[model samples]
Every structure is written in structure tokens, then in C-alpha cells.
Target: MKIIGNLFSKVLILIIVLFTLMPDASLVMAEETNLALKKEVFVSRETSGKEHQKTTDGLMDIKTSSKSWNAKSSDSITINLGAILDFNQIVVYEYSFQRANGYKLEISNDNISYTAVKEDSGIIASTERNFRTNAPHYVGVINIEKQSAQYIRLTVTEVLENKVSYIEEIEVYNSSDPDKFATEDTSLNASTDLVVDSAFGFKAPKVSKTIEENYAAGKPVFVSRETSGKYHERITDGIKNISTGGHAWNIKAGDYAIIDLGNAKEIDCVIVYEYSHLRAKDYVLELSNDMSSWTTVSRVTDYVSLNGETGEKSNAPHYYGKIEFDKTSARYVKLTINETAENKVAYFEEIEIYNKANKMPEFNAQPKEEEIKLSAPVVSESIPYSKEKFHIYLFIGQSNMNGRDNIPNSERVILKDVFLLNKEGKWEYAQPYPFGTKYSDYQGYNRYSSVDEGTKNGLNSASSFARAVTDNIPDDIGIGIISNARGGTSIEKWQKGSGEGLYEEAVRRTKEAISMGGTLKGILWLQGESCAKKEGYLDKLNQMVTDMRNDIGGIDDVPFIASEIIQSRPEGNVTIRKISEKIKASDYVSSVGTNTIDGLHYDAESQQLIGVRFAEKILNKIYGVTVTSDALLASLYNKEIQTEEIVPDYQFKIKINGKYLITDVEPIMHENRLFVPLRAIFEALNSTVEWEESTKKVTGIKGPKTVVMHIGSQNAYVNGVAVQIDVSPMLVNNRTLVPIRFISESLGAKVEWNQEIKTAYIELN
Candidate 1:
């Protein structure tokens, strides 16, 4: 008995193991064969009787009933399955009413031989009378005995109405249980369109809205305003509770987003759900096979925004709306919101695209090349340049970096030692407007209108920066600039490998500049305003620097310096501070600026000053050459002010670099010291004067230094450092006056005051 029990337990264990390893029988039986792929078709004569026949006009369109093929009276079409296929069912679709009383199906193993079903056989009769009213189409499913045949013939016969027998499409099924894969009535004109293949004769319904639905479920999206993951974040999070408190993809006019559908699809309509209380007034729908290239499909100058409750709702009415355009096949759909009705932010809660499956073959039509007659070859003279003698720098960023301010007369003259790599990729005498025709490749990334024009007014800091560098460096070493910048661009545009990305173009131009021969010294960047509202700017900029250094070979440790945007509004203070701190703390960046004018861009005077500051940074960091503010002043102005002492009244005469600073106003005694007009000395030192009424502050700038003082204030700041003055700056005759000794000495200039001779001397450098 014990031996028998042990043997029985071993047998049970073996049985359990065998059962665990067995394949699923249900899954194996559920698989069905599809024989309607890669087949050939032949028709006796098409209804149109033309080369362009409607019989083969994408009868497999599957989604919409707008396209159809017609067969009038006794029209027979033959289909070669290429191999023997066992099919149990056949379905035929009609665009209009069913006029054909019967369809006779014949099967043949060889094209020359055929076998037809007898008339008495019940396979050819149908009276279900089911039709898709919204799609306006009729389908007839005919059940047939399972048979294997290589060629099948479908004939429209037994015409009942006026000898007009129209067949929109046809399909065949390989499953023994024909209902297993039948097109359900619920799928017609429903949320999803049923896609059927009529060519191979299979009822395979592909989901037409798959592309858009997949995007909402987590696909990549890019926007002009926000290039980071933020663009797709709000859309794909699946949180459609569009309460005013929740996050949304908010944009202003001229900002747009691109939804990548992953592959090409025949698209016609798009649905957009806007944020509460905000709707885009104008929008453009565009399509593209390649993400880099795009063609506009439709433009909606005025679109209605709606409000709804829950599940894609905003506070406003009709939060969701659909837009239809000319049918087009594209892999990418770009929706650009041009303007908003209330001038409110164009915020979107969700966006979905609807497209049909592309049944046609892909054929990219190329433009024909025009024939050209060759003329005599022209020889060009080569200009010689020493590669090692040139020190190159790249100027990159948005409008402020491209320089919107006018160039001052004192700084307009072209410096012989400085060269500009213009848009044409040739080096010329360095001047303002680094973004010219040569650097116009930046237009590919610029979404703004003013940013693309080559003839637009541009005055950038590159020329001034080059001039300052050349003034400080030795004559043998020439300075060159690769100027590539666009106005109203964000840091996202500067990312690498992005289609129509400025960063990719910048690196390409940088490499091109390097090929022309030169030691790339550094990069000059001055942009931040566009992305100030968002975070992660530091990471994006750092990655850009790394990519540039890696792409532009032989410049691994190139220095990148940026400028702190002038934050004129209180709201921008934190963002500006963060950007400034990041720039100052970065290892790739050597130095950043503290100068700005009007908060949006630097003034003309500050632009030159910033340029001098850039030179100072390069000189000190790269060449180990120390540059003082006084050096910038002396090199920039080259003017002199004379001073004389009057012994009788104990009055002192001051001279500004061997010339008189003021011929109209003499030195006035205040608190036992001679005071001079602030503008007189500052202008003589090549500085600019501007008064801010909002802050009651007087700001003066001269090449790398800035003196900011408030009216009736005893304290003043020089280059953001605080210092006390013996006599506060006073307003006399609507001009600010300051103590000569303190202002001159603080700017690294020599100041001398003689009590007996009443004479004062000031040397700039």
C-alpha cells in the first residue's frame, strides 16, 4: 500500500508539470488567416472608361464614405489572391442605394479556369436591409461555403434599377465564423471610424483617430514658447479638469505648438479644448511629412471658444470646438494660435487630431531642375588670411544680443583689427548689426516676423566688443566675430538637433567659421527674457554650451559669457536674479554683466559699455591682462579738460585729461570743495547720461563702469558697489552736479586738489 501511494504521488506531480507547460488552446484557435494582402486586380472595363479609373481610387479608404467606385450593369472584376486563400464570407459596400439584385462570386485555382456557384445556391441572396445612414453607405455581407482559391471573380449582375449597379467597395474574410471579425453597426459614423480593406477583401477596421488619441495618451509635442517637456506636459497628463486653478499650455499671439503624429496619416479635422475664459481668435493648421518642413492646410482667422463642465471643460461656454481643413496626409500637425479675441492668453486644455489611414503609396514629388547652359568658367582671386593671427568669438542670443539700440557716433567707426563674419560667411571690417544676410539662417528658427528680415535695423554689441578687445590686445592679433542671432527667440530655439532649431544652426555656423581659420576665443550670449517665465533655463543653456563645445571641434573648454537682462518690472526680479546667479556660478561661463537699459534691452550707451566690459573680462580671464575702467575711458574718449586755480578767492581750477570739462559753468565751491557738472565730466569721459523719473535716480555710464546716484542722496553706487560722498549730487540749472574728486577717483582716475594754488588735476588712465 505504501509503495502504491508513492507511485501515485509521483504521477500526480508529473501531470501538474505537464499541465503548466501546455500552450493556451483558446488563443491558438482564435487566430484567423487574412488572405487579402498584396493581391492583383483586373476589371473588364471601368465605369469611367478612362486611364484614371474610379474603380481603383483607394477603394480601401476604410474611414469616410466620401470616396467610392461604381460598377454599372454586368461589370465584372477579377482579383488574384496570389495564393490559394480559404475564405468563408464576402462583403460589398455601395455608396448609394442597393440597385444590384444579386452578386455572383466565382472561384478558380488558375486564371484561365473557373467554377461558379449554382443559381439555386442560397449564397447570393441578401435582405437584412442594414445601412449606415450618417455615413450614407450600404454593406451586404454574403455567407459562402469555405473554399480555397487563388483567383476570385465578383460580377455585378441581376441589376434591378435602370441597369445601374454601383459597388463602393468589397471585402472577403478568411474566418470560418464570418461574424467573428464583422464590421459592427456601432462603429459606423461613431467616435471612431471603421477602416476596411476592399482591395484584399478583408473586413479589417483600423482606428482612424489612433494618431490623435495616441498623442493625448503620451506623445511628444513642441511649442515655440516652451521647448522643454512643459509643452507636452500639460497636454498628456490626462488631467482634463480645466479649472482656472489648474495648469495649462498658455501662449500669446504668434506662439504655436506642433503635435507629432509619429507617422503619416490622411488628416482632415482637428479638435481643440481651450482653457476657461480664453480662446484663440486666429489659428493656422499646417501639415508636414518631415518635421522640419511644413505646408499650411487651413487658416481660421476667427474661432469660437466654448465652456463646458468636467471632461474637457473650461469656465467659458463651448470650451471645445472642431476645425476641418482640406484633406492632407502628414506625419506632423502644427497648430499656431495667432491671436486671442479678448487679448487673453491662448491657453489650451487639450488638443486632439482626427485622421484617416493613408491607403495610397508615398511618392514625394521633386521639383524639376531647370536646364542651364554653361558659360566660360570665371576664375576668382583668393584672399589670404593667417589662421593663427585671428581670435574668433561667436555672438548669439535674441534681440538684445543682436542689438536693437542705435550705434553711437563715437563707437560707429569700423576698427581695422576687428573683422565680422557676415551672413555671406565672409569676414569684413567689424561693424554693428552682427545679424545680417550672412547670419540669416537664424530665420529658420525665428517664429516672429521682425526677427527674420535681413534688412531690419540691428545694432549688436559684437562690433563694440571686438573694438574694445582689439584696443586692449596686441596689433598682431586680429579679432573675428561669427554673428548669428535673432530677435524674440527663446532658449529652446537654441537646442541641438531640434528641427529648425537655432542651436543646431548656431553650431553649424560656428563650425563653418572655424573652417575659415581662427582660434575661437569664446561665445558672447545675451538672451533670457523669452523664457524668464519658466524654470530650467540654466539646464538648457548649460546643455547648449556643452553641445556647442562638443560639435565645434578643437574648442572644448571655450568660455561662455552672458549678460543679466535689465529687469525693469518687479515681477521679473526673481527670474533675472536666478539667471544672473546661474551665469555667474557656471564653470563654462567666465563672466556676466550687471548693466541693462529699459529692462527689455540695453541702451545704445550701455551697449558700448557692455562691449567694453566683455573685452575687460576676456582680457583678464584669457590673456591675463588686467583692464581698469579708466583704461576704457581713456581709449574711448581721447578728449581733454583743462583746470586752473584762482588764488584770490581760494577757488580751484580742474582739468579733465589736459582739457577743460566745462566752458559754460565754472567750478562752484560747495562744502569747501569745487563741484562740476556731472554730465560735463561724464560726457568728456565718453559716458551717457539718463535720468529715471520713476526712481528719482541719475545713471551715468562710460565703458565698463556705471555711476548711479539718486537726487539729494548722500550715498551712490559705482558698478553696484556702494560708496559715500562728501557732498550729495545737487540739481543746478536742470543739470546734475557732483563733487569732482569723488566721482573721478572712484572710476580709477587720478584726482588732485591743491588748496594754495586752488588747482585740481584729473587723469583718466
Candidate 2:
């Protein structure tokens, strides 16, 4: 429940105490003792979970695993030793992913002021290129003539080109002997090994050629002695798919981890997967039958960090080193690390012995799914039945408002008269996504929806709210959704006068929805993920609500509701719950349901439950209209289910000048010519249009230009001149669909067709 991070999200901490030192592990400190252990570590900026405490955890003195302090725009790390010590050496390490390739060490006496160490005046940075091909040089050690200081600061001045900064452990050693820790040559290939974690083979399977079974996995592992890091039992635990840090047995040079394969058997191939960042170069492998007599299998001595042997760590971190030889019959296999690829310590993720008996874990690789184009049902300007009220709501804020529910074509919620604002700013019958899913139609929605490589990236809170609200109201009444919710946006963006951002975009969409005929009954605010840990969110949110009321014309007494975010963000949840106190009518729904694709975003069932909760608050509190809840309806609908039917391949767009021609009826392609609704495009061209239902004819008039066309007729009259057209006029969804090219050309406007993006541009005269 404790979230240890910066006081303010993304804000840098200059001077603060973040940790309390634990009881002293060592009674007296010497050159062999790590003075930095159980001390306070202060970083400029650290991400959540990767706090500054990890830097002084004493896992590995110079090499780090997943236990690291990941920085955000970090500049330096200051370690407080609690008391002044005459230390001669300070060792700092970079991470497997974030490589602080260059750094400088500074000492502070007052803990407020600092000066560079006397041994080094310039920065300690490596000029090596293609660090992936060669092991990354990520160590910065300064052995100064014993200086008395309480605080030591390591400033990461330069980073590996295009790489981030992740600080691992920092070790300080005090010595009475002056020549204890001297400045050693650090520009060697076989000394320091650090690289990217996203490399291909870090957690992926890499078996030896013609080898399928692993005889050592899940077997008992016995190490000769304890090493630097932790977890010795992981040497035999399968390590192909999971790459967690602080795992595996960390052994000093010439130490061995013995994997007991239950009983002895014939073993031909031995593959060792060492920690990718700190790979072991030289290792002594032997086979033991009775723990006394042993046959030496292989002793690696000249391994050059696997630079040219495998793919670079930037692209593919070679997790395993394969050794295939003649079959050796032995009950036990001993892997003794003689030398490390980089530092003095080495760790193994997995060690597999092949004897053609036990098979590895089952791996089922699912290929990425292909997206099929789907066309939603054609929505009319207004519903067929009338005589009822039309309520509207603004679904605004962060990712929770914009969601993904794996609702199939059957569970996909659809009401009779509910509507969703499309990405082109038009209205479609209420469904999961109002904004078009395709990039060519509405690219912005696709940007957020297709972020994850999963199938459940559809559905929002608005559709379910509409269904619940409609059930409470009259049968003929309907709802139109003005959805402009952007995921991961802070409340600051929604505040009015924020300038040219989501604020302006939300106001524009609301105005468009309002202009189409509906009341802005309420505003649904579901943001604050970006600034979850920050303070002053309640005041900012109040300002945004007041501004939205003033700027988004009409309905001053409308209800404004905020939903409680996931329990993970407790601070943000507190702020959201406090909004009800600010606005008398507004309500805040409690966080509910599980089944999230990622633990962050709410899943479909949860999204549906949230929708119903919001609607319940609005209907009972805002409208003062409540009905006894049907437990079955709230949980699962037992009535006849309504399925969603989408007309396939029924979309094309018409752009006049530069702006999109937003219309209720979208343009369609027929007979190689684009057919758009006559009224919308004519009005865009400063032309007046008239339709005759009896004759099935339409006429467009702009200044002196006049064009006439009849439905299902191939001949058209423009300025009283008869012209033969390739495609006839048509009627679709009760709207007069006309050939756009013939109409634009007759009006003397230049029309250009772009096939790549599937749009027709018209330059009006």
C-alpha cells in the first residue's frame, strides 16, 4: 500500500531525506567493508518502485540486476554514509538497461556543499561506440587519498548515446592503508559488461542446436560457496521467459554452482545462460559421479564478452553460451566460473544439460492478429420515433474514460436510440468506439486504442451509461455522447484557457454535439492519472469544472460527475472523491471490478460496471428519477440480447478546401466514383439545395450556378444543359447521395482525387 516515490509526480527533489539507515551490519569499517551499506541514498529523480533505496541495498558491489534506481531526467546521486569516514574509494555502477556511461565523483562535508574528488579533475566517461557489440563500460571508481566526508555524490554527467540513466549500487570503502584502492586501468573489454535489457535473448528461449530436452531444469542446485548477489537456487530454475533482477546465484571468480540432476546420466550438450549484463567469460565445467572423481568437460578461458560472437545487446542480448561435446556419463554437473566477462562477480539465470530425456517448457507463440475493416450502421440525423427528451453528456478526461472492453459482437452494448460522436465529429449509433477505429478515417482514436497488442481495445463508459439511463427514462427518449476523453492526460489540460490542447478540443466537440440538437445535461470528468501523486489536484479540477460550465454554452445548473480511479492511485482517488464536496450535485463513483488487460487500465466488465455506477448516480441524484434495480440487469441481462450489425466497406470522405465535410450521412464509393450526400457538400460550397420527394429530384443553387439531378437517373442538368453521367444519382439511408465529381465539375470547381489515403479534395471557386 505504501507508494514510495517523489513527493510530486515527475518533479525533481533537490534536498530531502527519503530513507532511514538500518542497524549497522558491520561494527567496524575497513577497506574490505562497504561503508555505503545501510546508508541513505538520494537521487535527483526516481520512478515509482525504482526508488533511491535500491542503490545502497548491497546486492552486488559493482554489478546490478533488476534491483536499480531508474531515473527520470536525473542529474546526480548523493549517498549519505550517516557519519564522516576517511574513505579512499567510491564505486558506482550503471544498469543493464539504463547505462550511465560517463560520470564524476564529488564529496561533501556539510552535506550542503560539494567538491570534486582530488584523484580525478575531469569526468570519467567512455568514448566507446557500439557498446552492444562490445560490453558497455559502466563502472566509475575513484580511489582518492583517504578523504574524510559524510556524503558522497556520483553525478551522471554523460549517458550512453541514446540510452537512459539507471543507477545501481554505490560502494564506499575506507582504508588506513594508503595504497589499498588505487586507480586501475578501466579501459579493458573483459572488465565491465553492461548493455540493454530489451535485447532479443534476455528472457527468450535459446536452446543448443539439435537439442530439445533440458536435463538440469527444476533439479536441485548446490553451489560450492556463496557469491556477491542473492538467490542460489535459481541456477536450476528455468530462466528462458522471465528476466527478473537480483535472481540467480552470484558467484565470485573460480566458484561453482552444482546442478544435481537427480541421478547421473549421459550428458552431451551444456548451455549456460548467464546474466546478460554481467556475463561470465571464463568458466570451469566438470562432471562428477560420486562428488570425488570428476571429468573436466570444458574450461572457458578466452571469451571476449561475446561481442562479435552474438548479436549486440542493443538488439539481441545473448542470454546463453552453448558448449557441445562428446557425451559424458555423469550424475552431477559442476559449472565453476573462473573469470567474469566484466566485473569480479557472475550470475547464471539457467544452466541446461542435454541427455535427450526431459523437454523444456511448452512455448506457444501467438502471431499478432490482423485488423479487419468494419463499417458501423448508418445513423440518421435523428431517430425514427420522436416525442421524447434528448439528453447529452460530455465523456472527458484520461484513459479510463477512453477504454477497451473485449465485448464481442454479441456483448457489444447497443441501445435503440443512443448515439456516439464519431472521430470526424459526426454521430453514430451508440457502440464501443464513437471515433472511427481506422487510421484513414480517424487517426487520433487509433493512436490510443491500438497502443496495446491485445484484442479487447474497444468500448468506453458512455455506451453503458446511455443504456442504463435510457432504461430509467421514457422509451422514445435518447442520448447522444460527446466523447473527447484522452488517456493519460492530466487535469491541467482540461482546465479552460490552457491553450490549444485537449481543453479546446473538448469544447469544440461539445459545441458540435450541442449544435446538432441536445441538452448538455452533465459533464463526465475522469482524468488525473498523470498527476496522481501530486497535490492541488482538487483545486485544479474545480477550476476546470467551473470553466467548462462557463465556456461550454448553456445549462448552468447541469450535473458534473467524477469517477474514482483505480485503487492503485490512492492519492488521485482521494482528490476525485473530494469533488462531491465542492459541487453539491456532482457525484463520485467508487472504484469497482477487476479483469484489467494491464493492471492500470480498467477491463471490460469493470468498465461496464463503472458505466452503470455513473448512470445510477446521475439518475438518482441529478435527475431525481429512480427505479428499483433489477439485480439480474445490474449483473447480466437475462432478456433478449441485441447484437450489433455493421455495414461493411461503406466509408469515404469529401474534403472541401482543407476542412472535413462533417455530415450525418458519410460519403460512399460506387462505380469508381465517390458519392456524397448532396446537401452537406453543397452547403460547404456556398450553395443552397432543395429536394423533391415526389419526383425523387434534387437541385443545388450557388450564385448563378444551378445543377439538378434525379435519383436512379443517369442524365443530369447543369445550368439547363443536359449531361450524361457514368454513375447515376442514388438514395441511401433516406439521404440524397449524388456523384461528387460531376457535381463539383458542373459547379466549375477544381476537384483532385488522392487514391493513397482514399480522399477527394475539392478547390471551390
Candidate 3:
């Protein structure tokens, strides 16, 4: 029975041994399989060639003869070497009889096709003669994408004139084993020593007993030592040191220390300290994952200076503060004193690392959805003003219609003080503000207002009109001039339902003013320059009047007075005649003639005359007051009615290939036989009018070209080319009228007049 029991026990022990042996066998087979999968082969050419030897001092000298060459005549030297080899790297050395210019190094797989690997600059010839020596050359370091290469070539493109080139050495290294070609093991002490290349190794104090005692007592371990002749203390609170100057502990030349963070933590910052009085410098702080393969985090010179200036005296301690890690997964941190002060040592009192804060809370808050509503302005009902009691004039159109022509001075008439109601409902006087001022030489002629000339002029006119109308009626006349004008703006831009452009904004503002309290009386329409450029000028003008009348509380039929655009200068009579024709035909709109001394804008005298004409026409229709032309003439300093010879039966005849076409008119022949007032005539001719105040020129466009006729200048341009006309166009009575027949035919538009309808018409083919 005892023998049987002993045998059973032996059997059990054998079973346990076999189980352990089975795992070992499997592990060995697995390692073999892994090794077999990593197939790599290394090919080197050093052994077969003439061997060049180098000394232990890291320098080499090689000698080669030209007779050792296998020369080819195809302008390329091909080296067929290792077979079935995986090409990884190549190195070559060459010596020349003379200075070589350069050489192209190429690599190939099939020995036929080649790719240039590197181009090397030739070395200067050495003074040592007998077989000239050049500086040692490292030809090419290539990383081949494909693993196999059977042949490589070096083609010398340009060489120094009289030299024979001899290769001293060529080495090709390939690896079939990946592990052999991988980065060298740098974690060894030999590698570290090689990196430092110095003689010192670090040591530290014995703290095992103290650490064990602190762990038993559940308290932090403290290290106190005298370094650089000063006593320093360091306390570790598991992961970090809470005490100040923790990293400031000093150590001797060959001394080292370690701070165990107790557990793995995300390290955000690390601070270092030096000896109490001496500054620290030339040190390296590194981190490691497995207490090996350390990465240097920071290195700084003594007296940590950012701008390379020493801060030793600045009370700022010579320490590296807040050393951040690119990642937070490190377990061991190592600091090495690379170099230090000649007399003072390096030290670190305590190290600290912080984990980042939680960021998930910010992402958790989501805004609740809610209904939204868009608000729009409420249109108010219009308040009617009796014409017999009070008159409200709406000064509309461009800069001239606005009142930029009047100079502001005490000599000028002050009718009433005008104020603007700001968005906040505060009343602002029309005094000199930063944006608007006449005293600064920023006037109508300066184009500063041309961008929005009509708007600027409208504001000035409204202010002046307020002063003038208030002077006559006093308290009874609460003059409200709702102006809407944009300088250089065309009438088409002001059309309703054309999304709010500059002109639309003007019209909107005017309507808003009228809705608030402004009473409708007369619309002083002073715009035509933009319409003067197109063929359908009258139709567009008629459209604007119709649209504006419907928009401004249906005040279309309420005495709309049109101011004829003033001619620039030099030929004022011709422009006046053109303006007169339009005014004479439209009973609802009357012409306010050009009343300026210089002609660009209406002067004070002209402004008063314009006001009188507007008031007479409006008051007569609204109040049944008969305001005669004689009565209007009496108000103008009793100036005599300047009459010229009336051109009776004067007509324009257009013969296009012998087919007669009569030009439509209210092209009335004003005194001098000049057929004027043909908005339709100019429109049919495809001529556009643009007024430039700076040059005082009215420019006309035909097709892809321009013609500029200055007010005072006689020379004109046809498509930027200069030409002369018989009569220069001018501004008369606030109207820009040109000679009908002369300008019409010159612009390729035939002009003719119908004697039966008393009209002028233009025809274009």
C-alpha cells in the first residue's frame, strides 16, 4: 500500500512538469514563426573591393588607382552587384586626379531604367600630390520604397577638364531581418555615455529606511541635505510637492536623486531650484515610460534668461518652471546635470505634476428650442394739410435740388431753424456736424457729395427751405421738407418694388417722414441726369412720377414741379431750350430755370425765384389763387422778361436713306430757333448723360465709348477722342440744353420736326 501511494505522488508531479513544459515549447515555436515572417537581407560591397582602413580617431584616408576601373563608354557607369538583395542604404567614397565639378548618383532595379538618387558637389583637390586626394565624400543615403535592387549607376555629368576619377570605397547595406535594421538600443548605459561623451556618472543619498518609516506612519517622506554650502529640504505628497522651492534642492557634481510620484498621473508642470544663492544652468530634465529610453523635456542655461541676458541679479530664481510634457503617460522622470557653475552645484528640491480638468460638463448643456418672430415697420395713415392754411413742399431729386449751392453765412437769409429727429427721438439741429460741413471746402463741386449728391443736396435744401418758408408765414407756416435724393442717382433706381438701393432708401425715408407728420404739398422733382443717358428717358421719368405719386399718399396729381438740369457753362442757352420743352408739355410739372450766377447750382437769388415759382403754381391749383407770370416776375426784383427772337416753323428733318421721319416735340423752339424739350428724341438716339461737377462736364455715352463736353470748355471727346462742336452746350435757368440738330446728327441720331404736331423727333437705324 505505501509503494502504491508513493507512485501516485510521483505521477502527479510529472503531470505538473509536463504542463509547464508545454507552454515553453509553444512560446519557442511562436518566436520562430515571428522571426521567419520578418524576412530581410543585408548586402555590403566593402569586402570585395580594395579595403580602405580608418584609425580609431574617427578619420580615414583611402588611395585608389585608375587601373582598377571597369570603364564603360555609354556615358553611364553601372555597378551590378548583390543578387536577390533588399536594398536599404548606399554609401560611396571617391578620390579624383583633379577637382570634380559634380556627379549624379542613380539607382536601378533591372539595370536598364534608372532614377537619380543624389547629386554630389565636387571636392577641391588637396595639396598632397602623387595621386590627388579630395575630401572624403558620402555619396547618397537612400530609403528605397521597393525592397529589391540588382544594379545602381553613377553618371558623371560635368567634371574638371583633365582628371581621371577613381572610387575609393562603396558600401551597400541591406537587411532581410527587420530587427537588425531597426533603431539601435539607446536605453543602455553605453548609449547614454556615448550621448554625453563625458566622464561623470550621478549618485544619490540613501533614503530607503526613511521612505519605509514614512510609509508605515502614513506621512510624506522628506529629504534634507547640505548642498552648495546651504541646507535644503524636500517633501513629497505622493504625486507632487506642495511646498515652495521643492525643485530648488542642490546636489554635487556626481550626485543624482529621484522623486517617485507614488502613482501614474498626468504631469502638467515641473519646477526646479538651485542652491539658495547660486543660479542653476546647463541641465537636462527627461521623462521615461519604463525607467529607460528617457526623452529630454527641457534644457536651460544658468540664471534662466529668455532673451539671452543673464537674470542672476533680478531676484528671479535660476530655475526651470512649469515644464510641460507633450503627453501625460510617463511613469519615471529623470533629470541630469549636463553642466553647472564652476563652483556651485545643481539641485532640485521637489517636483510637481497636475492632471487636466474635466471638460465634459461644458458639452452637456443644450439650448432649448423656441419660436421666433420677425418684426416689420407699421405704416401710419397720412395726415392731410389744407393748402389754403399751410403748404408743405417735398424737395426731391439730386444735389442741386438739395440746396448745396447756397453758401452758409450771416448774409444769407435765415428762415427757420431746422432740426433732425434722431433714431432715439432726440431732435438734432441742422448745425455743422462732423459729416456735413460747408466751411471745410467740402461742397457740391467737390464730388465728396457726388456719391450721394442728391441726398446731401436734399438735406441742405430742406434746411434752407425751412428758413425761407418760415420767414414768410412765421408760426402759421410749419414747413416740413421731406427730401429724398441720391447724387448721381437715376430715376429708374427710385422705382417702387426695386429692392432698397440708394435711391430706394431715399424714397423710403421720405415716405417715413411724411407718415410721421409731413403734409403733402408739392414734389420738387430735380432729377433727369441719369435718364438723359438712355433712349426711354421720358417713359422712365413718367414712370418715376407715377410711382412716387402712388407711394407718397396719392399726391401724384398735387402740383409736381420739375427742375430742369442746369447746363454746365459756355453754351448755357442750348441746354435751357431742351429743359423748356419738357416743362411746357407737362402741365402737372413746371420748370424752375437755372438760377445760379456760375450755373452749377442755384444761388440765393435763384433759390428764391424757384421757391416763388413752386409756391405760385401749387397755391394757384390748391387755393384757387391766380399766380400770374407777371406777378412772379414782379417778385424777382422786377427784372424784365428777357425775350429772344421766337423761331417760328423751325423743325428738324431726319432723312434716313431718303425715308423721312419726323421727330416728336414739345421740342419747343425757344426764341433762338433751337428745338428743345425732346426727352423722347434724346432717348431714341441711345445717348446717356452723366454730370460731373468736378470737371463741370456733361458726358454722353453712345455705345462702348464716352463723349465728355465740359460746361466751360469747348473741346469734347467722342469715345475718349477729342472733337470740336459748332456751339458749346450750357446751363440756362437750371437746365442743361444742347443744340438739338447739331448734337443729334453728330451722335448718329437723325433729328426731324413735325410741323403738324409742333414736335421734334429723332430716328436711329
lDDT of each: 0.58, 0.61, 0.42
Rank by lDDT, descending?
Answer: 2, 1, 3
**Candidate 1 stretches greater than 4 Å from native:** 1-385, 432-451, 569-599, 638-765
Candidate 3 at 108: error in angstroms?
99
TM-scores for the candidates: 0.32, 0.38, 0.30
User: Model 3 over residues 510-612: C-alpha lDDT tens digits?
Assistant: 5665555555666666666545534655556667666666666656566666644542221222233353344322332223333442224455445545555
Most accurate candidate by TM-score: 2
589 in model 1: Cα distance from truth in Å?
10
Q: Tens digit of lDDT per residue, candidate 2, span 1-765?
A: 124464443223322111122223332233277889868777776433334666787644323233466543337888888888878877665543345645567899788989887433333432211222111324555668778899998776655433355566677887555343332323332223334335222222232332244677557678778645536766554444333436667766777777788887888778766553345766677898888888887876755233222221211133456676678888888877776632445556667788644433222323323333345545666644332266777887777776643343434445567776665566666654333442122122222221222222355666567777877777666787776766556767667776637777777778877777767788877777657447877777777777777788665678888877864455566567678777655778766333343446666556666677778777876568874223323444553322222211224656677555777777888999898888887888888999999999889998867898889999888778677888998878777888888888667565777774466778774
Q: For model 3, where is the 10-residue window of minimal lDDT?
A: 209-218
